[model samples]
Every structure is written in structure tokens, then in C-alpha cells.
Target chain A: MTQPAISPALPADWRDFFALTKPRVMSLVIFTGLCGLLAAPGSLHPVLAFTAILCIAVGAGGAAALNQWWEADLDAGMKRTAQRPLPAGRMDRESARDFGFGLSGAAVAIMGLAIGWLPAAILALSIFYYSWIYTVWLKPRTPQNIVIGGGAGAFPPLIGWVAVTGDITLMPVLLFLIIFMWTPPHFWALALFVKTDYAKVGIPMMPVVAGEKSTRRQILAYTVLLVPLSVVPWFIGGTGMIYGVSALVLGGVFIVLSTEVGLRSSVPDDAMKPEKRLFAFSILYLFILFAMLVADRFATIYGWQA
Target chain B: MIDDPRTHDLELFRARQKSRNRVLGSILGALAVLFFAISIVKISNQSHKKAEAAAAMAGQH
Candidate 1:
């Protein structure tokens, strides 16, 4: 008689646990959080600043893990997410959930004890925003999920700023708004291309629910709003002309590219090059824009106002 | 018998568990060091503030 083959019940790899944190997404969170710390009015001890950014990153990771835990079924349905640890059956949902809660609680406690209460409170709220508000409530139900969901990513900068200044200010709020507004156009461009995956999984992403035409137009609309909003920091003397000019140049390019995506009709099987271009440039745009904010601060210290 | 696949699988699992434990151990150590540093900084900052307040009071007198 032939022996029946059995697969070894192996434990999940350490890398799979790491992957649950969505490290790629965490990079942007860390960058914005650090920029917020850098751009704030007062100074923080370097160790404390590192701790603040670390808390933000860990909190975001916890939230991402929770998101994956809740969406495992939906993730398994979509090609883009089918390979995730939970979706792929490499990690158990219970482990993911435990890891999420542990990281989140540790991060919040450290933030409060090491930095201050306000930033810690905001850190906890951002985790709640992403895990409960965006993931559990909004995403499955609303086509406008990304709009409201953008708030989760916006808090890092605000938290970082508060860690330094220990008080809320207009500039950090503007930083928050820039991310909030930039999110819709940035996400929808990717949605325009991979909308089929979302549709298959019933996620109600704008492109999947609103159709490409409406999605494109809205992407352009948000870009138009974002350009002016980004330039506001300079207008109000919150930032120098370095950031101002960079924002203008970057926003101009964003508008031109978004206009292309906004104005054109995509063919059923086209490469979606414009949407792809906008998506790539949008990432570059925010990185450069925030970098300019820091650069402007550096320049002002060296006596270069212009 | 010396080359059984189940033994290899068990060995691999043990190795992964060991690696994860090491990482967790390292993180806990780092957290202890971090908390110590934070406590020191907070104490120093409080003392600095108290000294400034005392100076201001003396100036007022």
C-alpha cells in the first residue's frame, strides 16, 4: 500500500509576524512622524524624539496587524492580499490579534511614561482610528472609506509635534490636513488600476464603487484642493519660501498629472500609465514636500529666509 | 532513519522559535534601558525647573 503524504504542521516564520505589521506602510508613518518632530517649534531630547517616533511606528504596526486579523477572509479573496500571513494560513488569527494588542499597549504606555500624556493619548487614538474606525466600520460599508480613513495616518505628525511642543499648534494641524487631503488622490490612483481586486473582494473602493470616470474627477478635485492647502504653511509664515516654492512646484506637477488622469478615459485593457505615474509621483511628492519643510527650517537657522 | 524529514521539520521549528525568543529578549533589555534613561532625564528636567523657580523667587525678594 502506498503511504499517504502529510504536510508538516510547521510554525509560522518570524518574518510572517513582521509582515503582519505592514512595514512598507510603516515607513511612511515613521517619516511623517519624524518630520513632525523635526518641524515643531520647540526641541525634544534626541532619545525622547526617537522614542516618540518608535511609539508611532509600533502603534501603526499594531493597527495594521489588527486590520489584517479582521480582514483575513476578505484578504484571502483578493489576489493582492491573498499572500498575507493570515490569508495564506501561515499565521493564526489569535496570534495576530495578541501581537497587535501587545504592541499597541506597550507603545501607548511607553509614550505616556517617556514623553507625555497628550502624545500617548493621540497615539492610542490613531491605533483605534485605524483598527476600529477605518478597518471594522468604514471600509466594508462605504465607498468614501479612504476619505474618512485618512485620519488614521494623519495623527503621526501631530503626535510627533506634540511630543516636542507639548501643545497643539496650527502648523501641526496643517500637517495633519495635508496628509488627510493628499490621501484620497493618492489612494484612488492605485484604486483605479487594481480596482478589480477590490471589486472581487467587495471592498467598495472608490474606483470599484464610483466608476473610473467619477473616481478620476474626484482625484483631480482633491489634487486641486491639496495644492492650495499645502502652500498654506508658507502663506501663514509657518514655513519658509523653500517649502513654499517646493510645494508650488510639486503641486503644479501633481495637478498636471492628475489632470491627465482626470481628463482621459481609460480603455478596458490599457496599461493605466497615467494613474500609475500619478501614484508613483504622489509618494515622491509627499516625501519631497515634507523634506522641504525640514529643509526650510534648516535654511532659516542658517539665515536664508528666501 | 538518520535522514527523516519529520526530524528536519522539528529542527527548523525549534530554530525559528529560538530566533524569535532571542529577538524578544533583546527588545525587553532595550526597554529596560530606555525606561532608566527616561527616568534620569525627567528627574534632571524637574530639578532644572525647580532651580529656575527658586532663582526667580530670589530675584523678586
Candidate 2:
């Protein structure tokens, strides 16, 4: 815990604090949550809907802050994470911890009061899952951290659905599963290219614990499972052709890219193109998939070709 | 309280944190008030609609 090397007087700017929120990751959380709310059968008050998304964002930020707080020591050793506010010694650990708790507590309280309790309850659980279960327990100990911990990221849409419907249903659950299955491959793609970082930091990422060959095989396997699972919503009439077709096409590309990643033996610096492409496309694939869901719903409402 | 020299810096940190918390607390308080006002307006609007419907029924009678 003693980072004796960092100068005590180094000033922390507001951006350093903002960096703790993991804004890029929160964007996907917000998008998915919004899609869930919009795709639901009923309408919500716009104010309440905004509040729900805000809560999700704040909860995610808090979880990320806590994750950094706990892993500050581990992060300092890794080049990828060394510049994080905590690891960089731009912010004090106590402040980071307190900030995490404050944001999480406020988000949950506002959610329970302004919206419904179920979503708030799930939001709390999601934060706990990420900070405690994944960051604290699984990440240091096991190679399968993201596989099980992906539930933390999967909860936003489910929470958003519950916020609208005030209960669990099959559709939101399927959306959850879609993201859940998608996580391993998406993360493993990044992990494959960044294996050395994990190895250096002594984190048991799949690529570090298992060989790259095994990691690539698992990535392909998850992508294969994810493709069919993503289409389940359309098959069950939960979504329309817009989402169905988009998912099928996007999934085809995902399979092709992942297959290439799996089959390749040599990953030269310049030739790691497949992994890079997969990582980049995975983000787009999810964003487009969710966007199509919302578009499909609107199309159905207006009696347009969906 | 025993004045331990080692905790002097921590005491200042806590004081700073307390003031920051107070500011955040005030913002949350304002938000709670806004939500309360919204709820009240919604309830009043519903009741006003009910009263108008009742008056219309009475006139028909």
C-alpha cells in the first residue's frame, strides 16, 4: 500500500477524478440502458427515464473508481494502467475510495426514491459485483475473471428494463445473455494482443494463464455461441427484422474475424491486425445491435418496414 | 482526544472531505426537493381532472 516513490505534492486535477469514472466504458452502459428503456412496451416519464440512465452511469463510475482504488498497486506496474489517476498518484487512495462509496450510495438512493426499488436493488448489486466480486476476488486469482464478472456489465439493460416494467421478463434476460456471452470474446480479443501487459503485471488474464492458442480458441468458441444467442430475441418475436438482420450480418463478420484470430499462430506487431479489428468491431457491433433494437421498436410503432 | 502527531495530516484531510461532502449533500437535497415538487404537481393534476369529471356528471343530473 505504501507507494513511497510518488511525490506527495503532485496535484490532482478534476480530469484526474473524471478519469476514475471510466467514461468510455460508461458510454456503452448508457447506450444499452437507454435501449432497454426505449424497447420496453410501456412509456416512462422522460425525467424518470433520464434519472434511471444517470443512476446506471453513476453506479458504473463508482464501481470503476472502486476497482481502481483496490487495484492501484497492481495498476502501477502495468503500462496500460500506470497512468490511471490512482496508480499515477494524482489522487489519494482514501479520496478515491470515498468518492466511489459516495457516488454509489447517491445513485442507489436516488434510483430507489425517484424510480423503482427493483432497478435500484439491481444497480447496487451490479456495483458490488464489479468492485467486490470481480476486482477484488476474481481478477487476482483466476483466468476466468471476465467470463463470470461480465454480469456486472450485463445488468444495466436489465435494470433499465426493470425500471420500465418494474419486473423481470424474458426479453431483458435475453439481452443480458447477449452481452454476457459477448463479453468473453470481446475482452479476449483485447487480451490476446495485450498478453504481455497482463503477464508483466502478474494478472492471471486468460492469455497470461493459458497460452494465446487456448485464448484464441475460447474467443472463437464464445463468438460462435454469441451469434445464435443474439438472434434469440428476433426468433421469439421480442424484436423485429431490423434487429434480426443486423445481428445476423454483424455476427457473420464477428465469426469471420474471430476465426482468423483463432487460426493465426504468429502475431507479429504489424500482423496483429485481426485481433485489433475484432476488438474495434466488437464495440461497433454492440452499439449497432442495440441501436437496431430501438429502431425496430420505433419502426413497429409507426407501421414501417422493420 | 489524544493529539497524535502522526494523525495530523489525516485530520486535515478529513476536514476537507467533510466540506466536500456538505456541498454534495446540498445538491442532493435540492434534487430531492425537485422530485417532491414534481410528485405533488402530478397528484394535483390528477385530482383536478377527477373534480372536473365529477362536475360534468352533476350538471347532467
Candidate 3:
């Protein structure tokens, strides 16, 4: 007797479902949100604080899922994103959609009930912004997509601050702006090398639409704008010298890298060394900058050395 | 029977389903604990606020 045929595709497992959440990107969201919560003046009950961060993380995950669901085709076209669960055919679209909506709804509901409706509302808006505004609309249509999409990522810190303070303030708004301005240089650096994959998918990334020269110039411009903005909280007396000095030092290295990237002429078959360095350093820069914000706050509380 | 393709497929499917169920159960359990803790915190905070207000009123009177 002939052996029976076995299905080549395995059923989607929990790990595949988890990958739909884009946990790597979600980590950045959680870190910035946590820093915002920690840096804010007032204290929330530990439970409420945990809930607020949970909501932010889950909501970001939900948005990421919806993005994959919507962009599965586009993702499949790109070498970089082709391995994602939906793109790789590890998961079905309906499961992804249901999971996204379910996670988003639960996160908002828990946030509203446990924390305030205000932060919950912001969380909901952020999910919508990332899923619909960025992923569905701007990304396909415009070269400046990530610039506006920055707002979606920027909401975490603002939401984190508002969760504790229960209102918007200059400080929180500055925190939002810091992330907003930071997004482009960080993303465009990555885009500089990955432009080919974006071009394959017709996504109109900055580098694809504007070319490497313009993209590198814009990266340097955004980095220059970001350094001053990161230092603004200290200038306004919102943070102490710890953050201000760190901003200057970190921003100094950031400028050096950006300048190197911006000034260099691309060689044919080049490795994109400067752009890659800037890209990696940009992530580390933001993580350290936000950590300093929290550290400065604690120093104020405990009278530690700045 | 052990080498049968259909039986191997069935085993893998069952394993995937089992893993998904376990994850779902863990999430539900964590959520239950989270909600309960939120309720307790909110109740205590509300009562403390009420007591503070009542004491202030008494002092004014």
C-alpha cells in the first residue's frame, strides 16, 4: 500500500501567535512607557502602574498584529519581513485579526477599569494610529510615513506620564517630542541599508523614495534636531544635570556618528558601516537617555549624586 | 502505525493545540489575579479618601 500524504504546513502554535505581536518592537514601547511612568512626579499604586504598562505593551502588540495581518502580502514581498508568521504562512489572517482585536480590546478595558479612562483612551488611539494610520495608510502612500508614524510610538511615554499625573503637562509633552524626533534618524539609518527590500515591496521608505544621499542628509538633520530636544527637559528645569550632561555626552557621540554617515560617499558594493553603526547606536542612545531620566528622578528622591 | 503519516500529523496537531491551551490558561489566570488586585487597591483608596474628607468636615464643623 502507498503511504498517505502528510500536510507540509504545521498548524499555528502559541509561539507563532506570539511572534505576531512583534515582541522586539514591543520591548522598546514597554521600556519607554516604563521610563515615563518612573520619571513622572506622582506615584500610582504599584498595581495600577503595572496595569498601565501592561496595557501599553499589550496594545502595542495588538497594533503590531493588525499590522502584520494587513501587510502580510507586503511583508511577504520583502526579504526582511518575509519570515514573519503571517508572511511565512505559519498563521492564517483571521486568527491574526481576531487575536489583534481581542488583545487590543482587553488591554483598553483593563486599563480603563484599573487605571483611568484617559490613558486607556490614549492607548486605544495609539493602537488605531499604528494599525490604520501608519500601517494601512501612510506607509504605502508616502515617503514620510515613519515621520508621522513616530506619533504612534511617541504615545507610550505620554500615556505613561498621564497615567500617573492624570493630566498632560509640558514635561510629558516634551517626553513625547523627544521620542517623536528620535524616530526618523533611527529608522532612516536602518532604511538606508534596507532600501532594496523596501523598494521590492514598493513601500516608499525615505531611502527608497528620496535616495541614499537625501536620506542620509535627513538622518543627520533629525539627529541634530533630536540632541537639542533631548536636552530641553533639563533646560526647562524638568530634569537635573544628570540627564542634561548625559544628553550632551550621548548627543555628542550621536552627532559624530550621524556626521560620519552624512558626510561619507557611498562606495559601490559598500557595507554601509557608518549607517549600521548609527542605527545600532541610536537604539542604545534612546534606551540610555530614558534610563537617565528615571535615574535623575530617583536621585532627586534619594539625594544621590547626579 | 508509528511510521504512519496521518498519525504523525495528528500527534503534531495535538501538541500544538495543547500548547495553545496552556498559554490561554496562563493568561486567564494572570488576568484574574490582576483584576482582583485592582479591585482591592481601588476600594482601599476610595475608603481612605472618604475618611480624609469626613475628618476634614468634622474639623471644619
Those runs of model 1 whose alpha carbons end farther than 4 Å from true positions after fitting are A1-9
Model 3 chain A TM-score equals: 0.95
Please give the ranking of all candidate structures by TM-score, highest first, separated by commas. 3, 1, 2
* Candidate 1, residue A2: lDDT: 31
- Displacement of the residue A100 alpha carbon in candidate 3, Å: 0.7
State TM-scores per candidate: 0.95, 0.85, 0.95
Query: Which of candidates 1 and 2 reaches a greater DockQ?
Result: 1
**Candidate 2 lDDT, tens digit per residue, A131-155?**
9999999988999998988889999
Fnat across every predicted model, in order: 0.24, 0.00, 0.76
- Please name the candidate that would achieve the greatest lDDT relative to the true structure: 1
Deviation in angstroms for A43 in model 3?
0.3
**Each prediction's Cα RMSD?**
3.2, 6.3, 2.6
Q: Candidate 1: lDDT of B48?
A: 93
DockQ of 1: 0.36
Better-scoring candidate (lDDT), 1 or 2 = 1
Interface RMSD of 2: 6.7
